[model samples]
Target chain A: MRVLIQLRPAPDVVAAVIEPGVRATAADVAGRLPGVVLDQAFAPVAVPRPVPASAYGDPLSLNQRVEFSYAPQDAAVLVRGEIADDELSTRSVLLPSARRDVAGVFADPVIHSTPTCGGDGPVGHWQDVARLLGAPEMTVEGHDGSGVTLAIVDSGINAAHVQAHLGREVIIDTERSWSPPGVGGTPGEYPVAHGTMCAFDALIAAPRATLLDIPVLLSPHNVAGLLSDAVAAYAHLRTVLEAMPAGSRSLVISNSWGLFSPGQDFPPGHPGNYSDNLAHPFNLIVASLDQAGADIVFSAGNCGRECPDRRCGFPDRPITGANSHPRVLSVGGVDTGLERVGYSSQGPGRLSDRKPDICAYTHFAGSEANGPGTPDTGTSAACPVAAGAVAAIRTRHPATEISPAQLRTLLHRTAEDRSTLGFDHDYGYGVINPPAVLESLGRHTRHAA
Target chain B: MVLLTVRLPPGATLADALARLELAEEDVDTAFGLVPIDPGTGLYAVRVAEEASHRAANTAGGPFSDPPIAPHGSQDPHDRHAPPSG
Candidate 1:
């Protein structure tokens, strides 16, 4: 068990005096005690003074704990750990309590409480229902959500969405969390007006799969999240998921927003610019998600000259070159006819290589005639549709049959070419055809784990 | 510990910047390497020296600080406790 030891600060602790409290505690913690380790108070995980390690438990475990420094700059080091000493180890250290603001403030199950999928609002992709159910493949076996979880990394999804809460059957564990610099409320929510509409697209695709909606956007007054903050939010989502049973197994992630701000390179010391591998924290977060074998889908940016790359749109450029390395399913946009959307982001990323590997639907350049402005007009909207499509495909096949990366490769290999005979710059591996994809899947006997 | 909270800009990444801070400090080289931070939602869990957070109080509410903990509007001109007003 970890205890937060608040020691009276011995002045001269600030200007590196005596190396600060948490440092003091870390220095004071000798291996002789067999419990505490000296730690720098201000690290990514936040360890307050003498950071203690509890190896004996789980999130609910009576032992282990992951601590963060409450105030690195302050003299006090706030350390959180399991209760180790016998005396304080009552049945359960924290007795259940009926706190004041249970409903409006603190609610039950952080991720499950919000509205999403089948909750109350409109499902933008309901039109694809016919495409989903009739896909001969999904119904091959029964719905199996046992070990697979879909991590919808976007704005917070509404927990009340009917499909997410009710629907076809039972998916034992599903969740959601709002990590922010959230602009409005604490949990950055997926409103009818949120984050390029990727939030709802996932539910429309896989209503019954266990889900983890990690809301990265936090601004209350706007429709989207901040670039820098979005990166951090994605990172936080990874940490939160790392601790859960729902976190393990094959995961599918969907990200629609893209950076359109040219010359967005922050000064050498800017927050957006990180190491060689990570262009931003968001990039690192995406890489981390990929390392976890979570099948991820990113909108190939709706910056193609077909439509204006105006507003926050980046010319639908494939995530390649500098944006390469962290391999993921880069999805380009397609029209209803399985042809590439003129507005689909063109590729070979900034480094000009390894362009978009997959393709999905964007409304007639996004809006038909005028196209469906909100849900279909952008590649952001198209990314989620592809995500949902993958979910349906996964449910039909089983995780052992198809890993996220494999799924990505298969989709690309079988894509209908919108370009000449083979791979093109705009549409990627062409558009995704459900029946064609299903047929292709039947040909392969090799299972993916 | 001073908690500051603020929304991040659309294309900016909170973790990337945080990484810069880590670069100069060997103790926290990759502080946010495996662990990433999202700038959009709530108080993201992070660690800073108590004095660091206190000094952060000088720039407090800008991002890591939020309500139920710090006042939404902190009076200090160098208020790290208050986030950039919406």
Candidate 2:
């Protein structure tokens, strides 16, 4: 059981207390409770701290220090009182209420030993989908994602296999990439099947974009492992993005995983619920990243059908957690026939007006295996495909510098509507028409010029 | 540099072909070495060194024949939400 204690002390108290070290200060505070143990304290950095406002409250002001500690589950009542003393503004219990299994979180690609005969000649399915989305035209226009950087935040990618399949070295940086403290192995070394598949799918559209492989998920762990470490992983991601040399090029992040049921109710501060509340640490972190100009993308889970799979439980609600956040571009999936894939999660997002900001092709062929024809399917496939398209536009017009909100608006306006006449739960804005998006961007560029 | 489309006999699995071909486990890197043309049906288009073509064909037995590289049109029936089946 983990607990986050928010301590608000005057600047002088902070200096005096912190000068003695965070552990000592926490020990002094924890003296009130016998069983609680001081785990870690996050102090504001002298320079602009990368920690989110929700992490310590009003990060810009640097008035509070946050400490994460653990105590016996039975001692919750005793610990809660000591941490909520008059000096403390608020206290949050970061206990894991339920275990979120990683079973269906990372969608596995279907491996076909031989290509199925028929339909559109020998071209791969991704190429056909690309042509449908006007990617060929974008490629013709020299927007093959040359100047963009796509950070894949999932399980670690198999860099060698991805490079071999794509036949190029597109992973420019893995130096800033990381796994949790005890999760060993270099980011690129872990042969995480899901991350590699996502990399392949994203590269299908933005073949030339440099990949920043940040593998948040590790082996021998479940969804709870990722959820517990996500805050730190996200903080590390911000650092990685901040370290990039100043440039006009675009930065896009593709997250192919998310929590669904959360196993708890809203407004109760469940660890799994990355609710829209600005005070929610996870939301604040994502919002901070958005303000810093990284276009984040999340896969709407494969819960569209009756939810046979554990990951896609058919809840009464439309969507859940971070995928439903307003700032991120949540993506759903469609088959080649332009119908919603039975498993793509639908939405009237908890935060956004309508979710799945857009849809793209699943059943995609990409670099999951040794070759390019591996059948990588699911909304996991769709999120990166859409991200690659965004990267392609960013590659072409580096100076355009669109905000996250503006980019969402452009995609929503330009998408080819499907399902119902306008926005619906299943299709969101509709299938991405890359050619239309490029044309709109072209017009915007010319107008700006 | 030759690409061979090896179709498995009815009831034959990819593991069977790999064994018959005598390719070491290390030699077949699933990420880039063995290309799956149709994963649903056990048909693979493998790019082998020129000298290994005959051995691959002979290993494939009666089902060994060249087929045109077809466009992938079959919908994979596997659910992405389910735990991967071996």
Candidate 3:
């Protein structure tokens, strides 16, 4: 958390800060705050102390007319710094008492122009996303998702619709694909809907990657599926992952779905609860998959405070269950213009805080699965798009060579940080930068060689 | 039906699980079968009636909630609330 520290440093230091052309630094006014990393670049500024103009006026209340005094003894010096996000509450309370000179500590929030929201139009086309991701460059360097198997575990995918929109041959590994009980349609033949959009978006970067169509969401009564169905779907995927030789195994699962309402779930502290309980069967399975060398990517959900999906149920910290799993990459949405969409769920997640681990492109003109010209919008689109990038990298760096955990670290390290302070809830480790990831990989490969 | 996990050796079938838990054939969702949650841990899961889950509580892990999940995106961007299935 970025902060401004008001310190009643020595009178001379305050006068030095107030003096013209003196150029006093943050270190000069507030030196070595225990928990705060002082911004060396920020020059210390003298803040005038407000005194009641009339003797009758209350000294504490600012409701009456006040006089601004820059007297060296009365004035305070303001210095800039950041406290660790996790320790913000503890440190903010302790700072004033820890130093007698510390007059107050205040928040320094990131100010931004209006954020893009669900109702906003598409920012750019899918081709623009390709360009930003450096798809052509990735292909030239042999990172085109040649052998990786990317799974879309959502509504059944319509292969024809995805192929038509992608203008390329789509590979549906039918032999590996599986459907939930009573879901009638064959893999890749369900309908033109969310799953098809996810497929098209994933193919943007990993065109050659084999896709395993696991339509876990196609329940007989409705398009939505129970979380137990997903447990079964993942169980099937575990087998597919184990079937591959350990030395070359690479399976990426994309989940653009999540539990919308807590009313459907057991309450938070209950033993049967799914949202906050790590011991829940589904959460355990997610861990099992991660341990077995699968890169799982989940949408952070459409519960952003700015403009949430109507179905959003949790009052706060909506990223829940496996969507907030530490093992998986919880993807949030940003437009092609790299502005975060208002519907992307912010974190301090239910399961693991500091979630929505990264942002990826969405609200783009592609996969007209929604309609004639509707943008593939939401963290739903972002999840698979990021999954596709993972597949592209997995083409060369298999699980055996670079484990999924290591790859996650690499992606987090190489991302274009959106916040002045790293890893904020809104954008996580900033937007996913494929070019930077590829470069980092190139450097590591050469180093290893 | 709720989900429950039981410790079973690798390659154990649904019948084996039913027998081990002393559950009648009709007590579980046969179509859902016995799915492995973690083969390494010998942990397998099955969907069973809430009463069946309680009956097997001494041996099984949970009568875990199986909440409904929907896709994150709406069908139409213009109508942000449009259901994904619409």
Q: Which candidate is the best by lDDT?
A: 3
A196-233: candidate 3 lDDT, tens digit per residue: 99999998988999999988888764648888889989
List DockQ for all candidates: 0.03, 0.03, 0.48
Model 2 chain A: which ten-residue window has the lowest total lDDT? A98-107
Give me the runs in candidate 2 sitting further than 4 Å from their true place. Answer: A1-124, A219-224, A245-249, A264-278, A306-308, A369-374, A398-400, B1-86
Evaluated on chain B only, what is the TM-score of candidate 3?
A: 0.84
TM-score of chain B of each: 0.31, 0.42, 0.84
lDDT of 2 by residue, B1-86 (tens): 33344556545544655776765544432322343333335554443444565556555421111111100111333444342110
Question: Residues A333-363, candidate 1, lDDT per residue (tens digit)?
Answer: 6545455544456766653355676676554
| Window of ten residues with lowest summed lDDT in model 3 chain B | B77-86
Model 2's number of clashes is 15
lDDT of 1 by residue, B6-85 (tens): 33444444464344333223222133322334433332333333345434443333222111101011111212111101
Clash counts for all predictions: 106, 15, 0
Enumerate residue pairs that collide in model 3: none
TM-score of 2: 0.58
**Which has the higher DockQ value, candidate number 1 or candidate number 3?**
3
User: TM-score of chain A, model 3?
Assistant: 0.78
